[model samples]
Target: MDAASSLGIDKIGFASAEPFTELKDILLRHREKGFESGFEEPDIEKRVNPELSFESPKSIISIAVAYPSKLPNPPRSEPGAYRGIISRSSWGSDYHDVLRDRLAKLEAFIAERVPDARLMSMVDTGVLVDRAVAERAGIGWSGKNCAVITPEWGSWVYLGDMITNIPFTPDTSIMDQCGDCTICIDACPTGALVGPGQLNSSRCISFITQTKGYIDDEYKRKIGNRIYGCDTCQIVCPKNKGMNWTHQPELQPDPEKVKPLLIPLLTMTNKEFKEQYGRIAASWRGKKPIQRNAIIALGNFRDQSAVPILSELLLADPRPEIRATCAWALGRIGGEEASSALNNAQAKEQEPAVRQDIEKAITAVSQSASR
Candidate 1:
């Protein structure tokens, strides 16, 4: 339960390790499955390294940490054409930190018994497909939303692995419970869930947050107000109903990050950005990607207050991506002040792309003012 609490998992689920006798057999079968055939081999080597030797790993243990919390909807938007927004994850600290710590503790406990055993741990590294291992360990099956869904904790959990040289007993595998239901795939806003189990990670908002560098206007306009990750499919999952997973007490955000206003995030210096978000998972993409997201969110908000911040960004920021985004946000605000600033900025801006963005802002602002 300590691990569950740390992971913000409402309830924890355990899967026994598979016996060493079966390890070689399973590994062989999974290797034969291969990627070229449109099937991903569940073998750790294929998942992590094409050349990993299976002879060394004696056993694999899988664990599930659940994170289920009902989100209280944000206050309603004021009148005008608008779009909806969603919270990243309602209950906890970033799952990566919470789960990794618990796995570290578990490794220590195992080391006490098997002194010379080698151990490895991973959480959402993408190299090892987590859901497959969880399913094999009987923790849960990969649900339609592509999340591991256990009967006890629903689908809001993180999966982790501990591969050790010491042998242990493995648990039975779980069966897929999704019976022809395509709600998760159908409900995706950007159609990222192209099929029942297929996800185009490139088109995912969660992926967008992690992707480095600037985003084009086409992608920016569609992201809405999501400044971090996206959770539309997870919320729509029928299995996620009423699972009050425990919240990670330690993952509380720096007040600045918990409720970040779009304006200040764009203006933050590398030093200020480090001071504010350095410890969090969101810092990986550095300040620019987040600033880009913030600009998009401000555009979606169409809040007049964002106009000055956008204006300041046009003149002061060094990144051309940010300047273009500032123009986009100003255009969305569409007021006399925003338009005049954009018009003036366009003349002085040297980058063709940025100048084009400024001209686009002038047109959108003029049109909005006319209406």
Candidate 2:
């Protein structure tokens, strides 16, 4: 085998199918919403399991691509005002695109060797519990943040899996190295990491970013300037400090997304939003969530400069959710101008929830205007 194929080890033998018998029992619990099995969908059980055989499927090959980057510190004096905190993983192109391309290439290599091979690929898909499989395959141990942590890559890597009829040798699973470190749990701003190796998705900033509508005014204030994803837990982990890794160049973000200026993202048109974020994982939530997040970040920044943009969103956006969030942001921004804009928006808003938000904004801006 050539060097690339040799490194990927597509020719290795499969772990015995019998060993995976227990996997089904575990998957049962994983499909539940509150479970950490990482299986997000209920239907996945029918599609993948020990019983489902690849016509020639003999082994599963899993690959991990490290995504660690040298993160710069957010400005400390007014920590929340700093807009530099892009989730290190998402600052570039979507990892799914990068990992999928690499997996396809690897699958081709395996197919070249085994002509009749069948391949099923998953990278962060609902079908397979990626971290569990990675642990079983000996790639890394699950860290307290619930992310797989490789000794070399730290916890900053994207995982990919390919199941083929060709049996390949399995890698040995590694022992947990967390060693009682509770750094990730402590670092979570929202207490999302409630315990070791457990995450409450509802409390996670990353999850919040994916959600649309008026988040609790308090929650929006806590969200800081992160418009996409949050990486505070990962950032504080000792393992990830100063680590960099080999990344697929294609997945790198557009320069604008690297550390987006909050002002521009709020003003992006539907066409512009699509043009900029359409291909990214963040885009799955649509522009509304992102725009809402930008508004919150602007509120957190307390930069009156964002007042005009937030005001425009308050009036121009058709989505009641956006209107509500903008109202809240204007409240947080607190100025005579902000109050006037919110008051005007409140007059036109038909939605009760939005009208309430406008009232709250009026209250907050009224308070800020007094100061």
Candidate 3:
């Protein structure tokens, strides 16, 4: 325990590495309901059984490292110069790398003691369900929002786990403290939280923002100014109300990079995007999703100033998704310039999908003008 603290791991607990039989049933049901975000591991066995990660798994170690919730001196988003926000989960250096380094240190420490302690560590990308491991390890209780809420750090902690071939007494599981608390479910913008601890990830803004395609209009408008991820559920959770972790330097947010201006992101070259956002977790899907979300945000803002830039993208952008999203933004802005651009796109846009988008945008503008 002292060694983990020395290595800067916020919380650590152990649990029997028995196959998560209950979680397997739940996951299968979730798949049948089509609620998965497609980012999950397809093999349920790998996700539930630690033995799949390593032979002769005995116990699992779950760790949590809390991050900051509040963005100090956040950049203002006014009329013309609207900005987009990345969620706190994606704020600083990628949690995956940070947690992996901590896990590696812990693995080294364990090896020194046991000499034969076989270990495998995993962060978010690992096949194991991190929250499930955390629950079993007594790290925290799974909240109604599907976030593991710790009594000390609230739901602001990032989780990781290590599978080991050593017999360790398991920690007591934390009792669910979210009795009658539907705050997070009610606060979900897309109603992704269908029930307590049940998330329809397909409708989740966090998942939607990461998708590399044109989003449906309903979610696009709801996405508002969020570029990378959504924090509405966590932000509204009463348990997480006042929590703000800042001790970890690696998890601290760069205000400018996290809450960035929307205009500049639309035309960022791959090189520029890599230089600016390569280290952040949100950049995993590359710039296309973020840029596409930015266009939707500009449209949602209805900022007239963005019409020119959006118009150019509508006509000249190489990516069909970008051009199609630009069309939506232009129609949403709805003015002489925006309407003219959509009209021009209607003629020259060759892609069937893009053409449909332009026509819809033009019709939407016409409808708005009539109203």
Q: Name the top TM-score candidate.
A: 3
Error of 1 at 327 (Å): 1.1
Residue 192, model 1: lDDT of 72
Question: What are the per-residue Cα lDDT tens digits for candidate 2 across 1-371?
Answer: 35444443222212432235455665554445464423264555533563353444566666777664753343342333335345767756677887787778877776888887888887786366677767777778889998988777787777877776666676777899889899899889888887787677777888878776668765787788788788888888898877775444554545446567777776788899888777777777678787788778877887787788788878988888888888887888787888889878877888899999899879877776677
Q: Can you write out model 3's per-residue Cα lDDT over 222-243, one digit (the tens) per residue?
A: 9999998899989999998888
Better of 1 and 3 by TM-score: 3
Give the best candidate by lDDT: 3
* Model 3 ranges off by over 4 Å: none
Cα lDDT, model 1, residue 359: 89
Q: Name model 1 segments beyond 4 Å from true.
A: 1-55, 71-92, 251-256
| TM-score of candidate 2 versus the correct structure, residues matched by position | 0.86
- Each model's lDDT comes to 0.68, 0.71, 0.93
* lDDT at residue 312 of model 3 (Cα atoms): 93
> Which 10-residue span in candidate 2 carries the lowest summed lDDT?
9-18
Order of the predicted models by lDDT, top scorer first = 3, 2, 1
lDDT of 1 by residue, 1-371 (tens): 57544444444333433333333454455345431222244454456431253346756667776554553443444533232332445223566787788788777776777889787877776444566667776888888777888888787676787666766666677788988999999887777776766676666677775566566666776788777777888888888777655444554333335446566676688999888776666666687887788878878788777777778889778888889888988898887888888987987899998888888888888888788
